[model samples]
Target: MHIISGHHHISMLSKDAKLNNHFYQQVLGLRRVKKTVNQDDPSMYHLFFGDMSGNAGTELTFFEMPNIGSTVRGSNAITQIGLLVPSYESLVYWKERFERLAVKHGEITTYAGRDALHFEDQEGLRMVLQNNNGEKVPDTWQAWTGSDVDPRHLILGMGTIEITVRHLNRLANTLTELFGYVEAYHSDNEAIYQSVDGQSFGEILIKQDLGPREKPGKGSIHHLAIRAKNEEELRYWEEAVKERGFYTSGIVDRFYFKSLYFRESNGILFEIATDGPGFTTDSSIDELGKDLSLPPFLEGRRSEIEKNLLPID
Candidate 1:
């Protein structure tokens, strides 16, 4: 059986944490759900933005890299993020809001049969706001009423993530055969796949490109994480990936959830992360992202870590 649920989160690189926070939280209306440091590099900040309460499928995270260079556009990398808006009318609402706020965005267009508005963040992180057309699937995402945008038009969660790769068959096989994603649509060089559950939150769009490998930098997506039900499912995926001759990170304790990382043949990093204990494990829902949080292993060094990082505010 396919253990993957939907997107757990997508992590990217950012040059300035404060500006990134403002663009996503104030301008885009996502809530800052966590303030923490990169698990591997404690000196840098890791921020998570999502629906209110930081549900699994809604998270968009970033690792602050103050000196990072510009991303070199190319293939074999995550190219764009897709966020879900409630309806086509919501797209119009966002378009006007983007103009009033001076946010860079394109005209509304159809993508995989859904109306979409493409936009870029301050650091040039590309994203599309796709109208979900009011899909009635059950979800955990909560609208942050504190946001400037109306709750009805608030971004519900992440949708289709676009990945550009040279070897389409190899990556497609990994997604379909390994991860159990089923192809839902295809045209020209692009194809859309959805998880077994067929939710909009679980879709992926693959673009075939024979260009050079992407040089990741500020605004470049680091990895796409899919949901695993729990630690047991995470372990199952680790062995499955390893048995398939792929290198796996094994089960990793991420505090909020367990995770396992592996790079598919096309060089795109994929992470299988658990759904809980979610962001609320450490901080209460009301107090999330108010202060820096550290896992138990890093708690002892919190002072030193905080000293090296700039405050998001």
Candidate 2:
């Protein structure tokens, strides 16, 4: 059986491209790693933020669609995203930084025996900064040279994601049997799953959604991507999912990574993505995110795309 390593990236929707850029780049101190257009909707900007190099597990991306309304929070939606910092002291530093910036945040709290700081972005997208306590901490992606935050406390990568699901058993079985996730912890209404390979990036906390179904819009998670080692592994999953009667998008080339999208029984969008041909494929690492880039097929429309996109600070 083939299993994914962990999360490749998490994509969300945002209303204002400028505000989104400022929050992730300036406030969060993440590097603007890629500037491109959404593959399906070329009119909207698809922005990526991460550690200096935009490593696979570090990415938090967004689609800029100003016309979409805010998301309605309920069942069957990703509720929160977590980023990992180095230590408990780093959590303290962030609490003070959040205060100084007037960002709405909560006092440091403990969850699953790990220290966490809960906060929201300017768009009310819920996020958490947690201390690294997993079995194995993946390599820290380089910090941005111009970041305001200290390098010691910079976010390492994606930590965990929390989502609501109506069919917990089915989702849990698929995670364990098909994706190789192990049940790390469980309570009455919630359960945590971690990759069995001991990778630290793709942990998920799923809670029962006993309420109404969620409405997707801006500020909602668009899709969660899991990492495949390469094209062979990606095709393995595509075949596995298709055989199981799950509808898959069937290996779509994302330029950065090949992707296969399928929504599970709970209606949460999941993507299987390859880890190679990364953000630096077209642009050198030193020049990434400085210019608008398009896939070779879309290069003909570069002029139109440039005119449509708003400037990023």
Give me the runs in candidate 1 sitting further than 4 Å from their true place.
none
Best-matching candidate per TM-score? 1
Best by lDDT: 1
Question: Could you tell me every candidate's TM-score relative to the true structure?
Answer: 0.98, 0.96
- Model 2 TM: 0.96
With candidate 2 superimposed using the best TM-score fit, by how many Å does residue 278's alpha carbon deviate from the native? 0.5
Error of 2 at 87 (Å): 0.4
RMSD of each: 1.1, 1.5
Task: Note the clash tally of each candidate.
Answer: 0, 0
User: Which lDDT tens digits does candidate 1 get at residues 1-313?
Assistant: 7457788999999999999999999998999999999999998899999988888889999999999899999999999999999999999999999999998999999876789999999888999999998785435778777778887799888898999999887888888888888899877788888885557788898999998889999999999999989888888888889988899887888898889999998889999999999999999989998899999999999889988887668
Q: Give the whole-model CA lDDT for all candidates, comma-separated.
A: 0.89, 0.86
lDDT of model 1 at position 112 = 66
